[model samples]
Target: LLSLIDQIPEDQRPPIKLPPYDRFGWFFGRNESETYDGTFQVGTGADHVQNTGVMRLWNGANRTDYYRDTCGTIRGTTGEVWPPFGRLRGTPPNVTVFAPDVCSSVTLQYLDEVERYGIAGLRWIGNDRMFDNGVHYEETACQCTAPEDECPVLDNGAMDVSECKFGAPATISFPHFYLANDSYHADITGMQPDPNEHRFEMELEPYTGVPLSVKAQLQVNLHMRNYGLTLLQGIPPVMLPVLWFRQTAALTDELADDIKIILILPDIGVYVAYGIGAIGIVGLVLAIYFSVTRWKLVGPEELPPKRAQPVMP
Candidate 1:
């Protein structure tokens, strides 16, 4: 069977493709809103759990700046609010959960405010490094209907209900540096975002060989649509892509084998050859220079340098 599989043509083999992902897009103002609901399975057998928190901004406020809200609640397996729900009128909320073990799973449902602009969804995955610390990994699957009473204006002058579906799913992954050992910790780096297909890839150095007891925290940001007439008309809305990361214990060995098979020209080899060739050319030039100078000399010792020396008295 292995021999037969190897005999198959390269083109006949399945192509390597990324996992399913999504991205969040801001809505153009017109009294439109979006929501997302999804079930997440936490791997790595984490002991503790916490919601990383949510951020949002309205028109005239700084773009990409999020003020934490306090209106959301995280429910446990018993259907009771885990940390208790808080009211958020003008602010976003912090939805965190503390799970008992890694065997637990949770369903996340989030609703955005009704704005003339639509909502953008960001999906994320976590690494073991996020456990115990106040970090998280989350993904926003897609939008759904807002809670009955909390739904915003159905139709704004500029927005149509049907247009809200334009948003795509994106995967995002990055560390929540704010929860690091120091408040002045390094900013989350190595984040790659692909808005078109809604995918992201990031490597975590801290979570490499940690035991299964370490839980991975997924963090996601669901950006609400901005409704400013200037922004809606003048500036093109930027796509908020999602990110994800999967733990692979065998990745290191696999990568090492790949490097061995790959061919790369060595810089030292090239330079050494060039240096030897250059030295040979220089030696030939010096021989020629000496021959020419001697040919021009009156005698074997009559060259300028030899002549310049005083005769032995």
Candidate 2:
């Protein structure tokens, strides 16, 4: 029977979709609540505080891309911040291609997670406008260039200028909480055969302050569950777990402070059980107390008052 199964063509085999493991993507965002100054009387208050940004999972494709910028706004003596005017305040362009061909069915699950966070739009770029004492001020325009290894085409025929332009915008509605300056990652496995397998993983991290730096890292771990299965069958059952780590660092203290890290977990059953158990214990104790009090109030006198007097005599 096993031999017959082996004889069948690979296409005839049933498609097996496994649940994504610890494959995780992280995003960081600054919480803005900390920067508020209560005192109404103030000269151009200190620079507006930007909280650490938020994060999200990017599971659309095997390739990860990053784009970022630092924006600033000045405060007036009356405690008002101005927005970037014209082209000066506009966010830079960050674009990439996303399609089913670049990832496996299982890897697409990250898209579902992203939808939960309300980050559907493909706009990943950010710009800050700064005001110096109510005056529109401009910061040095940061240089933008792709890494040598990332832009292999640069080494080839006259660098493809088209590649520099932003691609068609792709929108993804993630189902998780995500904020600005978050990181995204995707990993695809089971692309190769036998001991030599092909897998692809990528990362994208965004930063929002001056001297911004984005770091994206991907790590893959392959473990053989049953070696014997490989000898008997052409394919071996294995477990592949991928992890993505992304971080954005900036020189500005406020921008660095705006960096937020969020860790989420799927199973909250333990917390639910604990809450239920606590409520049940409290209910049980109250019931016991009420029952004892009622029992104590019901005395023998309720049965017969005359009989009790005769017993005392």
Candidate 3:
């Protein structure tokens, strides 16, 4: 069908009568969110990855097509056993392409900025230098040479993630949604993206390095081009935004309840032990008091006088 669309000229191409397009997208039930069902067919044909029960993100499966930047250099100068994919890499583009989420961080300074500015903060958190968290927050967002930057490129605080996911076929992002720098907004001329709708965030308990609430969000897209294909000839040769989702783990009511339990259980035990200890102490004092009083007062009152021999009485 794609080839057919490509072969058809613009004038010959009618309204392109099609059904509800329920078949437009393929579902693997991997990252589909119940909260959203947008118009675009996400992961339509590409990124067809499924669980192999391996309990790992990259299971040696090729889930993406290899694409080059304008410089004609394939990503991953190292030996990529899987074309666009190299061996199991943790940071930069490698992990992001096959992995679900990139572990990134915002500096204490930037987080402080967010707190002060609310959601409109723009403090440079230094390019993904945070190492406290085990996740490598790639610096540099969008990884593009400008123009047609509609697809999401995560903020990841300050990490440059341009090298992620081969930097083209699909983009791994922080779910900035749209609250990214104005420069990104300027590049997106194809879509009307809402910053509030697509924004991703993390609320961390700074002192403890605990993520109070977090939304590890990212987006997947398709890089399309005319390339003499009649099907895509009418549209601009750009990376089209398909679907964006997040892996959100948060402090929910249940988790909060568990935490409360965790906090209160010890205290309850200590308090109970203290109460028992107090009772024991009080009992010991009362016993001592009763014995002393009986010996000194009751004993003296009830004590029989020392008697002489019976013969004398």
Candidate 4:
């Protein structure tokens, strides 16, 4: 169908018919079966604490063809898994994750310390700077260069993923346009952004680098504008949000308990050993001090016994 549309000359093409759907119905699910045959090669380093799982190959390619230059480079672990931080000196300021679906690597900023089931975790959340398309964040300028497709110049919080989607007029943003520009909310009527609910975040046990809880939220939008095509005509320039989704996960109670026993108990044992050794050293010092005092108290009386023994010799 795409090839057919391309074959038709723009000057002679007729008004294309669009699929039937309600105009206002943007939040709904469609029952469709899809198949994915992509391969991911990840290097499982010696263990969680050692050289751990980092992405080696994505869909049989080391680099993506979506964006140009370093923006297309594949780095960091897949969003789902990461190498263990293990006994680091301090909390990490950020964590890098390579999102294969988005065809980019995103850095999750450290928000705060959070605890679940008595286990402490470092909460990392996506900020306003990550999804920028060179409008607000200048570092992502390379991402604006779409290698094969014409990428739109979107405002902050929305990223053009048309090349990744095989030239579909698709873009991705935070759910409800949480960090998007005010103009986007003004253009749409039903958008109500909430930081508590719409934020994409992950909570990790910083010591083991285990994800205790995760809520990955993303909204898919269609850049609907007249591309000199009949079907696309009569539509206002708008980023029409088609659907939004949130993927969530959490650690079970049983697993949390196991982590405490495995990781927490050893520290308690070390503390107990130190306490015992401290007590023993204090007792030995007290004994030495008391013995010296007793000898000093008998000063002249103790000297008389030594003089009598010297006279007998």
The number of the candidate with the highest TM-score is 4
Q: Which ranges in model 1 have alpha carbons more than 4 Å from their true place?
A: 1-249, 252-266, 293-313
Model 1 deviation from the true structure expressed as Cα RMSD, one decimal place: 25.2
lDDT of 1 by residue, 88-174 (tens): 344333223322121122232222332111211112222222221112222211111244343322211011112223232221123
Candidate 1, backbone clash total: 42
In angstroms, the error of model 3 at 284 is 2.2
Candidate 3 regions with alpha-carbon error over 4 angstroms = 1-168, 174-184, 190-196, 202-216, 223-239, 246-259, 298-313
Higher lDDT: candidate 2 or 3? Answer: 3
Candidate 2 lDDT, 209-310, residue by residue in tens: 222222222222232233334443554432233332333332344533443321112236667888999999999999999988877798666644554545
Task: After superposing candidate 4 on the true structure, give the runs of residues whose Cα lies further than 4 Å from its correct spot.
Answer: 1-37, 47-50, 146-152, 268-313
Candidate 3's displacement at residue 63, Å, is 18
What is the Cα-based lDDT of residue 10 in candidate 4?
Answer: 68
What's the lDDT for candidate 4? Answer: 0.77
In model 3, state the lDDT of residue 206. Answer: 25
What ordering of candidates by TM-score runs from best to worst?
Answer: 4, 3, 1, 2
Candidate 2 ranges beyond 4 A from true positions? 1-159, 162-212, 215-284, 296-313
Comparing candidate 1 with candidate 2, which one achieves the higher lDDT?
A: 1
Candidate numbers sorted by lDDT from highest down: 4, 3, 1, 2
